[model samples]
Target: MTNDMRRDFANREELATYLKEQFPEAAERDDHISPIIGGRQAAVAALQKVDPVKYAKSRNFLTGAVTRLSPYIRYGVLGLREARDFAFSKIRNQDEAAKFVNELGWRDYWQRLYMKLGDGIWKDQEEYKTGYSASEYATELPQDIREGTTGLVCIDSFSRDLREIGYLHNHMRMWLAAYIVHWRRIRWQEGTKWFLEHLLDGDPASNNMSWQWVASTFSHKPYFFNRENLERYTEGVYCKKCPLYGKCDFEGSYEKLEAKLFPKGEFVQKDNSQSWQKGKRKR
Candidate 1:
């Protein structure tokens, strides 16, 4: 073959077929490709649909009004300022867009931190505060979890979505991370690698830092959630049909969960309502 290569295709399927033929090994490894389109046009279309007010009110839920612009921003097909300006144009007041803007601010913060930390972000920033030593955590991710057959409906769904769709709601991301680290006692780095492999918007900085946050290496305490908290945010969609409902690992009060998950750690727990009031204090 010469330096010149084919760049034109009649459709996405033709493109996918050509790619698979050229990179058969990659296709063998994991052939699933995301349905989310690329390029500036697709990015602008996604940006035009941003609903900041609805996002602020419902971003925590599974079917909320999330602006699916992360992949575009991550790849520079869309710029952060462009997204912010467009969101601001849609909102009537500053408060209406505060939460959405705050999310963008976090992306900026993670990028800056990545620049400073370099490769150091992959290592633990601090000691794990879960009362157990680093040696106690498992180094390998379990096959069941990776295959989305762990039998917990919520977790399995998230795992499948991560692998197949290359996307997940932020709340679901948190819950899944918590399950891997706290419940299964796996090292955060393992989960980090799994996410980076599948997420289209996965940036090492944001992904690693967030994993460390849940692992308690970058945060004050290990983040976790009770059944009630999960059900409330997910609207009980997973729990209602979950075969292990009421008997699963997540079924308990926050206080009970804290004591069980981190018996030797110093993570404090108050009543659910009071503790979860500020930030991730409840977890």
Candidate 2:
């Protein structure tokens, strides 16, 4: 509200009050994730600990050694160029660094796309790029998902982590988004709202586009992941604890998925062509 409020913090908890004043709803719904200590000095402290080499190898897994520099980067506490320089300064191996640097480029891509599209980001960039029509998807996320009572242990746990901590592993995000958009037929916007509310690093540009990416509004096909894929990457942690072990929602192959999820048409085959054409026409 004031210059002193924005710039001054006697204690780190002041960051929470400042954030509440700025985004009252988000701060209230996602109160568990602590307010990060503000300023460039704190940002640099987080940056100094980045290990780009290890990040490259294990970035896809839930337990990966990825740098959690997103909150800093999203809020402008850490600049991309400075992070790149720091990575290169610490690690001599260029190939290993490439994996991490490429992700930064992704951040740039989202920001540029947001600048270009503006509010259009919230609108469908394209039609249902998957097998179904835009009419088929639900406009809002289901109450169970918002309440974290989805019955599917893995998804429910992911929901709790996102709401409570305001951070999720990149892989967890993709998996959860894929399940919601493809398997449940919920519109990406529904998922986008929940993600934006909870994610500490929730950039409107990156977050919305990513939900679009999962929902196939901005990509070739809807991303799908089955139980096997989940267990493989997730180290069987959630599955082992899940109540619905074998007969859960995600048990099947591509063909089975089509029949079970979308019985009318095969989205993976060719229906997406019309959607692409429609988007092109609008452009």
Candidate 3:
């Protein structure tokens, strides 16, 4: 699939030539691609009105922060460098531009990590066992979670949004990860796989790394969410109407889990205990 020239060509000249011949002027005039491109132009026009400050404050708030550029990015319709440069050009303020730039950096970082680690990053880490199991839960569990049936108000709402629109707020992504890892006791890898399968903008590195970060496998501290945090963040949009609001038992604790994975405030050791124990046994 990666080698499919129709999707991703190394040179624009080749792509342009192909587009020109395959879609002559008369055909191009009547084709749907023109309208789709026109729509993107319209969206860009709207975004240009907001500029930097609006994007910085609202980007993480489950609203209009997203660029909706994923389909173009994924299909090679918009090249990565093109998006980066355009963002930088428009949002000239250092801090405002930095927010968008950092997100792009995350994309690059994930790609590099995937290339460097390959399948190893997906392997089970013994360190993840605390407060959660790495096993795939019953299919019903995922279905319930995805379908917003888990009863956790915030998670259910986000899950429903994802199912209906294939999108979730940035904060909601973290919330969902915490719920799946801490509340559901499911493996981050499983959650990552699920998102990759369903998300319209899913990229392996971002999905895996984000899951690991929430699972507390990649960072020194495990991310946890409490009802108060949810209420505050979501502006009381959740909890009141949740199916599991009163009945669920998970408390969203991370102190012990963080200590186990990230002792003495250090990043989690990359599970080298096997080699250490084997060497000691040999002695």
Which structure among the candidates has the greatest TM-score?
1
- Prediction 3 TM-score vs. true: 0.66
Return the TM-score for each candidate structure: 0.93, 0.84, 0.66
Candidate lDDT values, in order = 0.86, 0.76, 0.58
Residue pairs clashing in model 3 are 151-244
Per-residue alpha-carbon lDDT of candidate 3 for residues 1-283, written as tens digits (9 for 90 to 100): 5644376667656555677777587345332222223235644553455345566566655444657565456555556677666767775566767766666666777778779878877864335524434453322346788667765677777776665556566777777777777656677777877777556667776777777766656654456655655666566677677666645543333444446433434433233111100110110
Model 1, position 105: C-alpha lDDT score: 85
Candidate 1: worst-modelled 10 consecutive residues by lDDT = 272-281
Error of 1 at 214 (Å): 0.4
Total residue pair clashes for candidate 3: 1
lDDT of 1 at 191: 97
Cα lDDT over the full model 1? 0.86
RMSD to true structure for each model, in Å:
2.9, 5.2, 11.2
Q: Could you tell me which 10 consecutive residues in candidate 3 have the lowest summed lDDT?
A: 274-283
At residue 163, candidate 1 shows an lDDT of 90
